[model samples]
Target: MTGDNAVNIGSPQPPQKADVLARVCAALSAGDADTAKAIIDTDYPMVIGTKAQRRYTLTETLRTFYRDGFLDRYSGTQLIHPGALRTLSMLLPKEFPAHLNGKMTETHFAQWELFPTIDHVDPVARGGADDASNWVTTSMLRNSAKAHWTLSELGWTLHPPGDARHWDGLSSWFTGYLTDRPDLASSSGYLRRWLRATRVVQAERA
Candidate 1:
């Protein structure tokens, strides 16, 4: 698969809420529940663009959402950039768990004003040696969603939604936890850690 067809660089313009939603849809269509969860769990903050001034309040809201299982039921159909949608479809079935079957489709593609745009590069230019190298280099970005989401859940008690501090803390915690459990690493693990750390941090803050 060519890189253009395999991964979406997105528009040079910053992604809007709709754009991100489309990406989530594409991720789901590809049966990538993990990616979908990461989008909701991590990108929501980016979309909200909140500051770090009220760490404790922000963290609490995020933790509450997770604790209440709001996220588990937040599934929906979304539009995706065509390249990304195709790429994700090719990738997800091989990688994701079976429980998320049929979650991705074009049915809701237009509902959220999310749609795919064509990229300049040939999507097929994505899987050769150079592509492989680039993929490895970029793998960190893909792997980070789960870590960021986990950290967000954990740090929710300290930072507000969209706070950069929360993202930083999530990255730090993810790195620390993944160092010990590389094989067990996943969005689910991140959620569990968030729950565990939230209690610990709450006690400290208390």
Candidate 2:
């Protein structure tokens, strides 16, 4: 990664996928249980709630909670202060597999080459969270090409086999996932302002 946020590293030859994933796992194991319980659940989704509910891995679910500034979506009266979830996310990072389901980044990665980019189906610029519901894996090439463009704006379609190659599939699936929690769809105006403030700070450094 470069010091400049706006600059994309071309032909960036970085670490191997296994090495990167291992490090990510290490950082996660060190986090709190609320974060770990949701992540370590390899089974993911455990089970999707009525059609109203969408499937997601523990990791993505927690990322969403953190991104949206919450302790847990199912928990009542517990909330993480605004931007705290993002703060924690910045400190303790995770990735979304190419597949929205836990299968995206499974134990066997040798089969799926090219490291995964766990990106938000929705952009944080527009109030997207880190939740699995809003996240997906894609080629770094596709991600760089996508830069800030919404799924529909890209005019891509999802195939029935559920291939991750289609960058647009992530967004389409997320739209359905949000059927259960539309409130999580928009980050608070507070988050938008905070993001802008931080970007200015970053730009000053750049």
Candidate 3:
């Protein structure tokens, strides 16, 4: 058996599915919709809600919560799960008027159960008061199950966490994942452009 401390620098390790998922989550957290789109394209079909109660473009869905200006409006600790995504896709557009563009408070709880993680309260206090960590909490099994189901439905295979990879640089990371996937790149490119345009518009206003 290989020694536990052994280092095999020459060995080739395939990318793990968790690594990709984590990257996708991180990109979503960072408001990098391009990366999110690329990841989604490789894993699932962009399903828009057809019912009057639920209607939105995939772009709009991502934009509503993951976009730069709106991200901070929602709590970051809440993760998006497939079930919640499906539910939200069905519920959101129908609830709001077309001209009144904004998010509501209840939307935060729209997909809470879908998260694999449980929310843990922090013991540490900060700023002369209580500070807590209200992040998702769940067992590893549940997390893997959610990821597996999502990928399987999308006709994709998942890599094990042991084989996952990470990069500290965002641009390099995006380029690496997107370079060979032209179809994904194309779908994500418009979002990237939209983000850039938004930034430009904000800068001009500032």
Instruction: Find the candidate with the highest TM-score and give its number.
Output: 2
| Clash pairs (backbone) in predicted model 2 | 38-58, 60-132, 64-131
- Model 1, range 90-174, lDDT digits (tens) per residue? 3354453222232445223221222211111111222112221111111111223322233234332222223223222233443
Q: Please identify which of the two predictions, 1 or 2, would achieve the higher TM-score against the true structure.
A: 2
Ranked candidates (TM-score, high to low): 2, 3, 1
lDDT of 2 by residue, 1-206 (tens): 55757556576655554555565577577875455454434323233222213345433433333343322111111232223333333334453122323263332231122223445556655556645656654433455566666677677442221222222212223334333444643544534444444334324434
lDDT of 1 at 17: 71
Task: Give all candidates' CA lDDT scores.
Answer: 0.35, 0.40, 0.36
User: Could you give the candidate ranking by lDDT, starting with the highest?
Assistant: 2, 3, 1
Model 1, residue 183: what's the lDDT?
A: 59
For each candidate in turn, the TM-score is: 0.17, 0.25, 0.18
RMSD of 2: 22.7
List runs of model 2 lying over 4 Å from the truth: 1-113, 159-206
**Residues 1-206 of candidate 3: C-alpha lDDT, one tens digit per residue:** 37997768798665576777887899999999898879867754344422222233333332332222221111222333222333334335456222222234534333333322321122112111121122223322343444313333445332221101121112233334444554644554443443343334334434
Alpha-carbon shift of residue 109 in model 3 (angstroms)? 17
